[model samples]
Target chain A: MSTFRRRRKTPCGLLSGLLGVIAMATVAAQEGPGLGETPSPEMLAAWDIDIGPDGSGLPAGSGTAAVGETLYMTNCFACHGPEGEGLLNDRLAGGHGSLASEAPRKTVGSYWPYATTVFDYVRRAMPYLMPQSLTNDEVYALTAYLLYINGIVARDEVMDAETLPDVEMPNRDSFVIAYPRR
Target chain B: MSTPEFPEEEHEQVAGNGLLHRRLFLSQGAALLSAGSLGLMTARPAAAQALDPWLLTPGLALSGYGERSPFEADVARTVLPVAGTTGSGASRTPLESLEGIITPNGLFFERHHAGIPEIDPERHQLLIHGLVERPLVFSMEALSRYPMESRIQFLECSGNSRPNLASTPPQESCGFLHGTVSCSEWTGIPLSILLDEAGVSSEASWLLAEGADAAAMTRSVPLAKAMDDALIALYQNGERIRPSNGYPMRLFLPGYEGNACIKWLRRIKLTSGPQMTREETSKYTDLQRDGRSLQFTFDMDVKSVITSPSFGLALNGPGLYQISGIAWTGAGRIRRVEVSADGGQTWAEAALSDPVLPKALTRFRMAWRYDGGAATIVSRATDEAGNVQPLRSDFMAANGPQVSYHNNSTQAWAIDSDGAVSNVYV
Candidate 1:
């Protein structure tokens, strides 16, 4: 947390220094027409919704799996099955060790590499019928329920910004990046 | 040596199964009629010709936005919405019915995660933040101020030619099976200039690009690519981009998979590592035969398909026909495209058309003299990087049958004795 704070602060100091250096160096030659405006924090907050694997940009909200289950039944059960076995939409749970099988069922527990993506995707594009309608707390509960159903978390465990980032997913170590190889 | 008095045989086979030489058209255009080998210019009984009604009458006046001929009503994109969703699917370009390399703006293939968002360019703003000394936001008017460059490039969905992976060939048209790829002239500002203006931090290695659509389609692109040749494309095919193809602006990464070019591009945040977004991790990744999926497989490998004389495009008692097709490579220009009349047993080089630009579709043609026998014709393209389109068996062996993305194998079209064409595994 201290490192994150320091990293964030260093950019501002560096930016001020960059302004002076850029004025002398004429960095505008490389940069295109300087017409872009510096976005305010509130403007940034409205559109900056992406959550990285390390829990960056995760909103402040908490929900337990028990609460998540109720939210799931009400919001997600129509498309995603009751236990996330999948019906009209994507299956969100189970398929823990099926990646190597003849017919791999790539559900959340099976192929996804990060737990934060569960929260990120559910918050942004879930329910299929009406997306981006869930509250941050409701999104947290739904994500918690999915994790619990996938057997990655306990039923009573609380999922928030702090604890969600620490949930080590099953397929976290299975990915192999194919670009910019050394 | 003295010139021979006798004319050379116009129908001489260059390769197995009646594959004529590339110069057959030039050498025997006038002679083909006298020899009666090609039925293209046979003499017919002269009769009094009647003028058509349109020739005698005045044509309709032009409209604000001109449209194609009403006679060409059937030549439209094949829309395939997902079973449960309205707009969360793809529409294929009509490859077999079209000619030349440039896909018309309207007929361009579309793959949307959510429905096309109705974005007012006046209201939309692009934000560039994270791992940068200066976080900047550019509106449409501001973005247009920057100098731009245009290049003719091809964008292909990794899932194009997916039907070729099946054990038995699918009896579908070339467009239906492999129409998710299209080429266009994209004009846009270079992303490197924007990144430079934003003062990218040296620690950043990846960029998370997000769209403004309901799905908020997101993908992580390597920073090196952004600094190399990525574009903030606003105009496509000499006009403002269509709404289905990301109207206001889109991230156009030349030669990369189509999905990575986020439509309705709204945000680009620099990061130290990949965000492992849903599209990259779970959807677009290539699952191999060993059950290990290959992530960040951006390059859409070398591929080719014979659009004409393919399935559903039957020949009329084939005497002479020009086998035309489009060949492309994600790495660079297509160096060579070879057509096979005998289904890969023998190969003959096809004549590439003019303006063979890098990362753009190259049109290839081969003259053929059919003997009215059953035959399988296929095209094989080799890119500047020397990457040849893999054989079907070889490609299938590398990636299992279940894998859907990045199928760039050679496609074969079987011509029966009745001059009927059908998709076949040769």
Candidate 2:
């Protein structure tokens, strides 16, 4: 009976002086307002889409270059060119041995340090007009197709989270950290 | 080329090609006015002019917001969009037309990959997760309640001054050649407070900051920098941040390149190592002469550029003119700026403005008396860290000729006998 009465009076008190009570409690507790809420797992699932080079956050999916060709023609060719030669947007393939040349062509196959970056970028932003719209499998296929065209992977090679992290990029060891030595 | 007709006086010639002392104007303003028209004040006689309508009539009523004068409409940032797109491009600040160090919010340069997003402050939230003891989310209102601090700092894109890398000097305006940098007074809550609230894990060495735009831009920053002086900036130039500059909030790392200061910031995840995002690997990396590339280059090099008497701002009849420019360094405060008027054969120390804060633009000025001859002029800056700005040839020799980023070479402008100024490789 006493617990029910205390719970019944709580809503009325909250409606009357909730902000003032919280303000006082916050000043007594910490430096900040301390209004940060613990994010739920559902919220994390919806927004935490970044994938590390070690394939830490890659979702469950599988695809091949053959399946990616159709998706590429439908969505990517308008901006990135038919063969990834770069039409209106950036070039995605070729330029394997041009880094030291007078006119270097910086592309994914030639300069990218990690293969996981391909999946992270295409999943978050691709097709120029519509970003964050591709599914996990479709993003994997596109990554496979790009790697295949660049001669990094075979046409029939499967690209899942397990195999994608092992695909070594040619320029993986070509970088040196330039600042904040630690 | 003709010499000065007036008699010689206390104005000391500091360097070759008629470079005068730094304090010529301040020490001898009244005496110099009696000498001649110093070539700057060319206004028409006021006695011959009638009363303007603005003075004779009532002015417009008060407004909630204000704008620059309509007569100054021509002073605008020059935008160059990417092919077949309107937003994925850069716009340069009119550095030549502006005065002082603080760039007005409207005139700040912009380099956006997926355009600006109109974010509602109430709906925006900042999530701190990953290798943190407490994964938390804070609303804009909650963050606003935290203690805030304000700082005046300069932000520069690493891609600024790309034309200087060319062997032949390109004919372009000073702003067009090197205007990707701007300074502003940013107000924000120190990011350390938020990190403290989140209780960062001991294993975390780096953190990935992501944006809320269509591209969802992301970059991995060292935890040392975050624990240092980084901020979650909410205001620019004493007002709410402009849409193009990250409306609700943005991450601001003092002295770092502009792109690393993610705009429209939404998420931060502590990690054991860098995520190696495409923005860092496929782009923003600097290529070296020996085929190796420099990654995670955050600090902008010490640099300076002369804004006045540059290309398109021709010298009128070559009399006494004030040479002015801006200098900044990511390492620390700018200690000195030297001006050269005779193709860098000699240099004269210019006067730096007061309160030379670190990571902020320092305005330097020098008094110069032109001799109506073809002359090459330039400026170079030295920071408190003992690093001097390099010449184009030396910079290119160090970092390959094909390199396109962090080109902090001195810019040379030539003034012909006809008083027309153009970019020249000296």
Candidate 3:
């Protein structure tokens, strides 16, 4: 790789090589001749729980808005309010036509460009109090309910990994690559 | 009311001839004493006079560590509350009270998503996996054994001057308006060293840097950036990094937005493409006029802020004053900083402090004579790349009023007849 070749020309490479030799010698004198331990696949998987936009890491689960209503009321209502209008926390519904307005209310329906982001955020961090406590099915149901309330999907439409990424959000075409341009 | 404390004979001697003799003798002695004391005072070196009283007296001897003078009050980061819990807010550096280009380790700005996590260095491990030849787990001790590099750089929140975009900007101190950014000398191991040790695969194009905080805040950095100037920072201002500033370690992206720096760095997972994390998509992305949000808007544009004679500072019937501020650019070194006393009609170059490293804050100063009339003072920065700071109006016209991040427009501060300063749009 070019990155590897470039590393040799950098000052960091020269210093690291010198240090690596000394570190290896020190380790050999003590226990063994290695810098770090090899990480187990299980250990990596425990923390490697990131879902990509292309639906790479989504867990298998399916639910409809009808099933999500009860979960939303119990788990999400206190913060997001009934109908997802939002009260204590961020407003998830409405703001569809407010993007061009002077006072833009950037909600789930108004600004978020990707549908997978909603699922990723809700799964990684949600409820404001208890995070990562929702089951895969519960996350799917909540995602469907949020999409339904935002007028992106029908109330009875079932959402799973295959169907969730296909749902075209209103602002899907709103994002443009900013870096490497200016 | 009670007066008979002295002996009758002593009182009489004091009041009578004895008093006259005592006065005469004391007058002669006073002259001699004054001469001797004056000689002693003049004999001492000029440098000795500048020493503090504690330094003059033999205080505590050398110890394991040193501390600032007790007389100096602890300058803390100014915390601004936002929605959510206390940890979900931001704190700014007291830029007005600081000197030199490097911000003190403690006063550096802080922005947390969920909260700061208490991590044990012994238990903490930084995993370098995903598209690597060898998936390695490094302990804090092991990480320290690697070669280290130190650099002076500026880290700024993308929303540093977000309030300036407001229709009515807050009448606050320069530190409050522009303090969300800070410059520091950071010491750390170049990430390329570790990445090379793991032997990064050719297919990896992006690296997801995740923090160990409660939020587990994550941002996808381009592989080129990670290998370029990025550092796994361990020290700030030559001391171990503060707990609030990521303690054990943090990823330092030279000129990128502060959020991408990822405090309390725990993992670096190489991938083929950006993960499009919640932070990059929902929050840090910038909105434009055509309703098209700009994604991966990393570079902070050229910006300058007048620290002195800024908002909240009252100039007392001004004569001649030294106007000072800091100017920086994410692209390169600041080439020039121009100050405007009568809005933008007239401009004067400010003297820039030396050792103006690229991507570091450059301190600039200028001398001004105030006529005591109403005037608007501002500073505009021009970077080495020839990117000049834009006007607020021009910036708004292009980015739209709804845009909230990456605003590097020139700031104007109006001076009233009473010598009071306020943030204003001229």
Candidate 4:
């Protein structure tokens, strides 16, 4: 409990506490004018595609690093380079400990905090020209492949919605929520 | 038929006819001169020339739509080459060419994650789901029906002055260095009103605003801000918002960074916590010297720049020139702007333009008599909240060299003995 208390004093925890205060302040019972109609469930399902850090809203799909390599080589290697080292685009792998150095090459492995975000971003926008055209299984395969290249996971490990969020990233503890004080 | 036998007699007759014709021509010329004098008495050419050109040339009638005069050059936004793809870069406003506070719709700066999406207003709908009781979907028509409000405010990118963070001072024009900020009279409905209409749940702490562009760009805004001064803007500068400025509707947070105000807004999902989206994390987050990053640095600090006599502008002998520029603050209205002629040694308060609005660009002017000796001019803004614009050295001391975003340090322009103006850190 003392260790938990110490953790709560961090910048991230302070921000979370501040958000809680704001939420509590606005919880007063207020009535609405009741404008706009409720959308259909089908419409909600289609647009409610954002996968949070906790693995919520991830589609039912599974793939291994081996399968991901094939998909990545065929589809993603054009702009992302052969090993996701980045060509004319963003470099995706091998930037560990560079954030502290003068030249911070912030790639997936070096800076990204959540593995779920990698899946979400890839699923939402990827392949440069063709976005949202990848299948569910293809997205999982690509996510697994990217993780493997970043050295975050083994080559034979299978990635699904359940297993993806549990895969701890190297920079998980690097992120801190801080709002500049006046 | 006999070819008129007397040739000498015919020649004398022809000369007499010529004299008669000359007399007729002189009489006609005298009549036209009299008429011209009479017309001059009724109408003045000076005033007529000053009137609309359309009146002079009535043949060139109105077209389907009016266009700016051909004399006025179409100022294009300066695209910053940062993104991998062509579509995902930012364009800066042409600040040097602009006059007054409101940025023209076409010349307004644009930052797109996935290029501008051509959205049909009828087909586009704003979905308010997640922690809302109603989970409502508002079409463009429905959103327009809500109570409307308009306010003139400035929106600046967080990375507006990132180039200034370099070890060496940038030599670009003031517009090229600081053109990512623009002011406009935005008209829209209060986001609080919409949240009320949708019946926001008590547990909601954050709102995830997502765009309809190919990138589906998302940002998590604090619910407190949404309930405070946020707006679902539909119009800019008294007209419908331009396609580049976010056509049908956009989330406009008056004092927040430009990215917080998502363009082509499609969905806003309420949540108990921030989603930690890509923009809030990997992109806009500012890195510190210690390697930790600062997130949600939304409000742009007070900043002022000397637009005229800046880089690329030359002063001709420099007698008494009115040094004019803009000052703004995200926290509140600019209380005052101080101009330093000798590079921060002594400061004089500049005259602020009338109708000094809150969170809007306040044009300030100061008269300076330059004797052509080397001189540096700088302006510093102080907001009503008592936040003063810091010098570059002070800002670097506080935020370090690794910090790039939210740089509102006072900028100095050095004028050489030859009357050439250039950027310099004093």
Candidate 5:
């Protein structure tokens, strides 16, 4: 118990209140809805995923910033922005000089470390439900479109195999190397 | 309280909101059995029993074929409840309630940030481009012909834990905390063969895996791990891989973090290094003591905990309850599991479900009897490499505040006099 988080000072009350307080604390700490309770362990393997910075999870599908413009305008525009600018969906890109600035801005071009990740997320779990329902081509295009909307890619630039990975994200070096070995 | 052992005793209650108990939703017609034939007077009993008529849908004996779970009586779920913000994703599977190794494929639990996709396995081709001398596209059939191997393994989501999942009375089932991990005998082609076919370029240091699932789930795995023990799985548990288990194909990185195993996999692009994504950056990274985040810490460090005799269970005077649960690790295999009814104060080795394959969920059981007083039950697992699971206290002391992900800390359950079980962090 010593190593556990130091117990907060108990609220002042009667002596008998202590047992009730502990019981209540224990009750509150049940910590789970305790549903099926079967560790299944089998299902665990089914739900894991990794979305890369470059959006590696992006499917074979492709999409364009224009189509992304239409999709964004319809579904995401309300949350992201009119043209991927900072708004409800947060900044899609930019913040070029905000890395070390006081107000650290997390934009696609400035803070995002990889382009594959944008594709991965957009495909794997995006639009939330109906996840991965988008055609692979659509994900690639949406990735391209998002990049383009962030001013990272040119409007007419076809975002496909040849151009996708080469699209250097601003945070390429923004992230320090993880998994360092001694 | 002496209810005999027949699954038909299955509880059938639908909460006002439509979140079936995960399993209850499976046999929708199971409860439609007429009690009049069984000589029961109550209509409620008739509404909850499985009749011989329903099991004949595809027949109880599934010869040379896989069948959807006959036990999904309570699990007619579309998606997990989204309880406002502060939540990333959480989904529950039917575990404690499930029997046997192979969980019905469709009833398999899913946790997608985006959504599931519909792929025409024919039009869907896995493109192995980038940093490869020969960029090849293998149709699902072509890949199936490659040297195939099968594995009984478990995949565990890094963030699947219930350390702070509640502020109410404890949940009465074990599935909530441990259901995020499951095991399956997945058969697939060796990625090494595919990479060899693609003729990976020498400069290729990282291999990026992508899935068709929305969120276009992607992750950058080291080329070494990629070529070492990776798989391009095509089938799971003797059937064509279920659409959710990546269907046409998925990249299975054995014994590594679950996210690295891309589902609905469609492509593999060899690259230079870790491509930090939202999963690698904004989430999944462990914030350590010195304000540093732990990354690339891949192998689910060998850990195990008893799942049964866990929270939300009723003691029923505890004469002899089988203390059983799962133990596993991304590091090789589980060597041994020890259970303690007294919270590790004393210990005894538990029997492991045999063929304890590497990177798989090894089930373990030990008979435990309660002295009829307040008591704590805990289980610890040791892997083949001799890595032992740490105690909750030890974990708390070393790790400090736990993160939302990768918590394999030892779990304990305390039984009260009233026969209620709750999570015990001790």
Candidate 6:
């Protein structure tokens, strides 16, 4: 439903569209879709927070884990620890075997069920004090550092929106969606 | 002098700077006995508390300025925290710190899921529609004419302590535990009276209360609760409601979670069942194992914690420090609060502060003294309904982590030789 894209019958585009119908329409007055009217364009813009099953909210950003290492040192390393094991805050890494115990020590790569949620949450709010101040690229790099510390990715990996969504999380399969069926 | 090494020898001991046993201040056996035998027997009134620099008696002579000025520096903005979990980012009023059956309007705790809305009184309206004999919208003037009565009651957030009772209970001072709850003398038309005015149909099973905030937050209340004790509150603590605590108007659902008592209230649409709003469904509901989720868990149940001599407080010396704390129950008046200084090994009943009204926070005080040794303190509250506050271990063992929100277990803090206080697993 997105006015930005359409089924133009370009044979190759048909194959891509056949996999899934991504109808993100940004319009109203034509009796609209989704069983109701779309929220005002301004409201929609404010609340257009959706992280795809594959990580949709990942903004247009790219980063090298090496650059992320530098950014983490300056921005998040103090509270989150030199390698994200936590300092005054909490351990954001480890937990390779913590989920089933009395305490579930959650971390980025180990407990988070989605890569997209990580990128989306960091960009929207992170570092606690200077939340949303980091550029999208910095969020990507920081997320890369957290993942690398959790052993989910190689420390040298560079990530962009396209590739960031594809990065799988360790506990993604463990999370059974417990809602919407209610 | 022995390196302050407390090996925990199954006595629930913690040794460090300022580490008192979570049970030290909470216990009674020897602590209270020794306090009676040796505590500083000063004849000072409760009003003469040294901790509060601004402890003013209620209805004091005042200038034209109407609102209290405790948090006046931020009055112009009247802003709440950006989101959940706050301190320097955004703080809140301390209700427990005040000594009153009714918390002042400005001091009523703020629980804004969204920021406080800038509502224009002129354009503001209260619409009562759907499943009623006559759907009607009441302007502010019309709402004032209905018979008004004031009653003192307390409201608490369902998720107030979701983060407090971790492996180590936070010694975040009493405001954090008891502060999330506030009591007020609310003046408004009883909701049942309003339903009579609206002529609600008997078939109406639920009432959907929605706020005008940007979130447009909504929740459904049972008709029984709506027609029973809920009030369309206009005044709080004997004054016009503060904007942060749902000024202009709010729904005061007695003995229910504060979230259900919607603020900046706008509409009341009667319905057959719960709307399953985002808050009740996705967020507030406690997800238990076996894919079962607990929803509509309304009542706040019985809970209490000692505020004074709580965490973060350091005693210059341990002789004759009066131990005091607050306790309350959504069910009824708190019957008693047991304090254990020896980590639950021994207990003594504390005296309840006067005017202990049901559904209002009760202040309990007991005199205790320290004998130049480190110890732990713990407090447990028992309500009229036989609901006693659980120990942390008992709570976590039965409830589990997936069960988020409403963890009103007994909170324990340890005091050390250095007069430092800390939260502990015990």
DockQ each: 0.38, 0.40, 0.37, 0.23, 0.10, 0.02
Tens digits of per-residue lDDT for model 4, A9-113: 335877877864564358532223345788999999999978788888889999888999999998888778899899877788898888877788788888888
Tens-place lDDT digits, model 4, residues B61-80: 68996676675765567877
Clashing pairs in 4: none
Model 5 residue B226 CA deviation (Å) reads: 1.6
Q: Positional deviation of B326 in candidate 6, in angstroms?
A: 1.0
What is the lDDT, from 0 to 100, of the residue B5 in candidate 4? Answer: 24
Q: Give me the displacement of residue B411 in model 1, in angstroms.
A: 0.3
lDDT of 3 by residue, B1-426 (tens): 111122232222211111111221123432322322221111344456565887778887787877667655655667876565777779998886676799987789999887777888999899999999998899998877766778999999999988887888788777788889999999988888788778899999999999887777899999999888789999999999888889899999998999999999999999998888889987898877667788998998999988877776676663434567899999989999888888777676776877798999998865454656787888899999999999887887777877898889988988898878899985
Q: What TM-scores result for chain A when each predicted structure is judged separately against the true chain A?
A: 0.80, 0.82, 0.79, 0.79, 0.63, 0.70
**Range of the 10 consecutive residues with the lowest summed lDDT in candidate 6 chain B:** B1-10
What tens digits encode model 2's per-residue C-alpha lDDT throughout B201-276?
9999999999998889999999999988898999999999998998899999999989999999999999999999
When summed lDDT is taken over every stretch of 10 residues in candidate 2 chain B, the lowest stretch is: B33-42
Tens-place lDDT per residue, model 1, B58-102, is 999979999888878988888998768889899999999888899
lDDT of each residue in A92-120, candidate 5, tens digit only: 76676654543445566665666776765
Against the native chain B, what TM-score does each candidate's chain B reach? 0.93, 0.95, 0.84, 0.85, 0.80, 0.80
TM-score: model 6 vs. ground truth: 0.61
TM-score of each: 0.91, 0.92, 0.83, 0.84, 0.66, 0.61
RMSD of 1: 6.9
